[model samples]
Target: MSTAAEIADHKSSVRERVWTELRKVAVADSRFHFDFGEFIADFEGGEEAVHRLIDHSFYRDAELIFITPDNCLDRLRLRALQDGKVVLMTTYSIKRGFWLLDPAKIAPDHYLYASTLDGMERVGQHLTLAEIQATLPNVDYMVTGTGAINHEGVRFGKGHGFFDSEWGMLYQIGRISVATPCAAVVHDCQVLVEKLTPDVYDTVVDIIFTPTRTIEVHNPHKPTCGIIWDRLDQHMFDTIPPLQELKAMGL
Candidate 1:
C-alpha cells in the first residue's frame, strides 16, 4: 500500500495530466469562458452532460439540494427550480458564502434566471454560518462539479477544496447527516477506472453522474470529523466568510 504522501502525490500527478489535456480543449473551444484553471465545464459537451444528472433518481427525490455556483450547473439549477426544489448556492469561489434559493420566494417567470450566479446574487438570500445554524433544514442531497473522480469515491474539483469545505460546513452544522448522499456531475471521460485515495478531510462522493450512466460508489467515505482547521491558514479565515463567521462565533 502507498503511504498518504505517496497517494497525494499520485492524485496530483493524475490531476495535472488530466487538466493539461482538458485545458488544451478549453482554450480552443470558442464558447469557453474560463479564465482561471482548467475547469471541467470548459471541455466539450461538459455543461450539456448535466441533462443526465438532472434525470437521476437521487436528484428527482431530493427536496432540498445544495449545489455549486459553477455556470456548468445552471441548467440543473433551472430544472431544480422548475421542480419546486429548494436550492442552496454558494458565492463565487465560496468567498462571500452561501445563499438559500426558494422558488416560492422568486417570481414565477424568473426561475430560469435565478439559477445563474448573477440572478442568484440578485435574488438569493445570503446566509451566514450562524444564520444557517438557526434556520437551515436538513439537506436531502448534495451536488457539485468534479474535475475527476474514481470508483473508489475519491474526487478532484479544480484543486481548490471548496466542495469539501462546503460539505464540511454542512456536516458540522448538523444540516447534513452521515447518510446524506452526495453526487458529483462529470463527463464520462472524467470517470477514472483506476483508484485514487481520499486525503484526510477530503469529502468523497457517493455517486458520479455522466451523460451515459450513473456510477455508484458502494464505499463512499466522507470527512471523519468536521473542518480540519489545522490544515488551514489564518489568511483563509480572513478570506472565507464561513471561516470568518466561525472565528467571530468563538468556535
Candidate 2:
C-alpha cells in the first residue's frame, strides 16, 4: 500500500480507538463532563505537573520544543527560558486568540515558526505556536508531540494534526537535518506499546518527553514533502496558503 493510504488507515484506526477510550473514561469519570479545565487537571493537574516534569528532566541546556496550544507543556517553555535554555513553541494565530501560553520573555534566537500557507507570517524564529502562525518563515528543528499522528489501528493526537503538518513542511524544505533534534512532550497516557505503522508525511519524533521520562526514538523517519494537494482535507490545513508554497519550495 502507498504511504498515504497507510497513514489514512492509521488515523482512522487510532481515531476509533481513542474515541472508545475517551468514551470509556468519560463514562467512568463524570468530572470530565466536557470541562476543559477539569479534564486537564484531572488527567495531570496540567501545568503544575508539567513544571515538575521539566525540573525533573533538567532542561537547562536542552532545546525546549513543544506542541502548540497544549497548555500543559507550553508552560514549561517559560520555565525553560527562566533557566536559560533555548525554547521553541507553536502557536495558533496572532489575531484569532491569546496564546494558551507564551515564551516571549526568554527571547531565544533559534525560534522555528510554522507559517500558515495563506502567508500568515510566523512571528518569531524559534517561535512558539502563535509565533509560528503569525510569522511565516524557516528554522532548524521541529518539535512533534506524541500521539500527533497515527496509522492502522493506531491513534495519535488529542484531536489535532498540527505537529504532523509542521513536520511535513520542515521536511519539504529540507530543514530537518541529522543534527536537528526533534522532540515532543507528552503525558504518560499518550505513549503506546504497540509498534505504529507509519506513513509518508507522518513524522516520528526523535525524542519524547513525558512527565516521568524523556524518550528517544533510536531511528527516526522524516516526513514526505509536496502536499498531495487533493488528499489535503484536515481542518488543521484550512487557509494554509503557506502549505502549498512550502511544498513548491521543496520541488
Candidate 3:
C-alpha cells in the first residue's frame, strides 16, 4: 500500500504533467495566464464533452443536478438551466455556501449569464444548510471538473477538498446517497493511463466524459463516511461558512 505522502506526491506529479501538456496544446483557459490553477477549464473539446454529457441517459433523467463551480462546467450549468433542470452549485471554493439555480425563475435572456459564477449570485437563490435540508429534493446526479483523473475513477482537484466537502455535506443531509451517480467531465488529455491512488475522502466517479469518448468504471470507489472532520483543520472550518454552519447545527 502507498503511504499518504507517496499518494500525494504521485498526484502532484500527475497534475503537473497533465497541466503542462494541456498548456502545450493551447487547451488551457487563457484568462488565467500561464498557471492553470485547479486544472484548466475551457479546454479543447470542452463544449463537445458537455454535449456528450447532455446526451447521456443520466443527465436526461435527472431533475436536479449538483455541479461544481469550475469554469469548464459553465456550459453544463447553462445547458441545465436551459433544459429546466434545477442546479445546486457551490460558490468558487464553497466560500459562500450553496446556491440553487431554478430555470423557471431566471429570465431566458439571462440563461447564458446565470451559468457563470458571477451571474449565479444575480439569478440563483442562496440557501443555507438548514434551508437546503428543509426544501431541496434528493440530488438526481452529481458532476464535477477535475485537475486530472485516471481510468480507475480516481480524481485530483487542485489540492483543495471542496468537492469532497460538498459531497460530504450533501450526504450528511441525505441530499445525496451511495446510489447517486457521479461523473467528471474533462479534456482527453486530462485522463491518465497510469494508476492513481485514492485517499479515503476522495470521491471516485462512475463515469468520465471527454470530448472524444466516455469511459465507465467497472466498480468505482464511493466513500460512505461524510465529512472526515479529523482531516479538516481550523482554517478550513473558519473559511468555509457551510462547514462551520453544519458543525454548529450538529449535522
Candidate 4:
C-alpha cells in the first residue's frame, strides 16, 4: 500500500495536470474562463457531458436530484427539469439557502428557463434549510462538478468545501444515507489515474461520468457520520445561514 504522503503527492501532481487541461479548455472554447483558481465561467463541452449523465441510470431513474449550480452542469439541471424531475439546488454553494423545483409546480414547456440560475427563483420555491429537509425524500442521486477526481472515487471541489458540507448536513439530518449514489460529471481530462486521498468529511463520488467515459469507483472508505465542524472556520458559521442555524441548535 502507498503511504499517505505518496498518495497526496500523486494527487497534487494530477491536480496540476487537470488544471492545465481545464485552462486549455477555457482558452480554446468560447464558453469558458478561469474563475479565481478554478474554471467556472463556462466550458465548451458541457452539453456533451450532460449526455453522459443522461445515459446513466443515476440520471434516468432518479426522481429527486441534488445538484450543484455550476454552469458546466447547467444543462444537466436543464435536462432534469425537462424530464419533470424534481431538483434541489443549493443556494450559491449552499451558504444562503436551498431551492426546490417540483415538476408539478412548474410549467413543462418552460423547463429550460426554470433551470437557469436566475430562473430558479421564479420556477422554484426558496426554503430555509429546515423547511427543505422536512419536505425532502432521500435524495435519489447527487450530481456535482469537481476540480479534480480519481478513478478510486476520491475528489475535490473548487476548495470551498460546500458540496461535502451539504451532503454532511443531509446525512446528519437523515436524508442522505450510505446507500445514496453520488455522481460527478466532468470533462474527460478531469479523471485522474492516481488515487486521491479524502478528508474524513469529504464525500467521494460513487461514479464518475465524464464526457468520454463512465467509471465506477468502488469506494471502500465511506464517512457515515457527516460534518466535521472543526474543519470549518468560524466565518462559515457567521456567513452561511444554515451553518448558523446548525450552530444555534447546538448539534
Better model by lDDT: candidate 1 vs candidate 4: 1
* Separate clash counts for every candidate: 0, 32, 0, 0
Q: Write the per-residue lDDT of candidate 1 for residues 201-247, one digit (tens) a residue.
A: 78888888776677888868878576778887566666898976765
List candidate 2 stretches off by more than 4 Å. Answer: 1-10, 19-42, 45-67, 85-88, 93-141, 146-155, 158-160, 224-230, 234-238, 244-251
The sequence of per-residue lDDT tens digits that candidate 2 reaches over residues 1-251 is 55756766766676556444443333223434543322221235335445544553334334434334443444554455445444444444222321222245423442222122121134434333333544533343444334322222122654344556655554455444445555555555555666676556555666665556555566677555535555566453555545645544544
Q: What TM-score, to 2 decimals, does candidate 3 have?
A: 0.95
Ranking by lDDT: 3, 1, 4, 2
Candidate 1 TM-score, true structure as reference? 0.88
Task: Return the lDDT, model 1, position 28.
Answer: 43
lDDT of 4 by residue, 1-251 (tens): 78867866665667677777777664332333465243342455767777878888888899999998776777888788778889988766566577888878888876787787778877788876677667878789988888888788888666677888788777777778878899888777777776466878778888887667788988535577576777686776677887776656565
* Cα displacement (Å) at residue 197, model 3: 1.8
TM-score of every candidate:
0.88, 0.58, 0.95, 0.87
Q: Is candidate 2 or candidate 4 better by TM-score?
A: 4
Best-performing candidate as measured by TM-score: 3
Per-candidate RMSD, Å: 2.7, 7.7, 1.5, 3.1
C-alpha positional error of residue 4 in candidate 4 after TM-score superposition, expressed in Å: 11
Report lDDT (CA) for all predictions: 0.77, 0.45, 0.87, 0.75
Return the lDDT, model 1, position 102.
Answer: 94
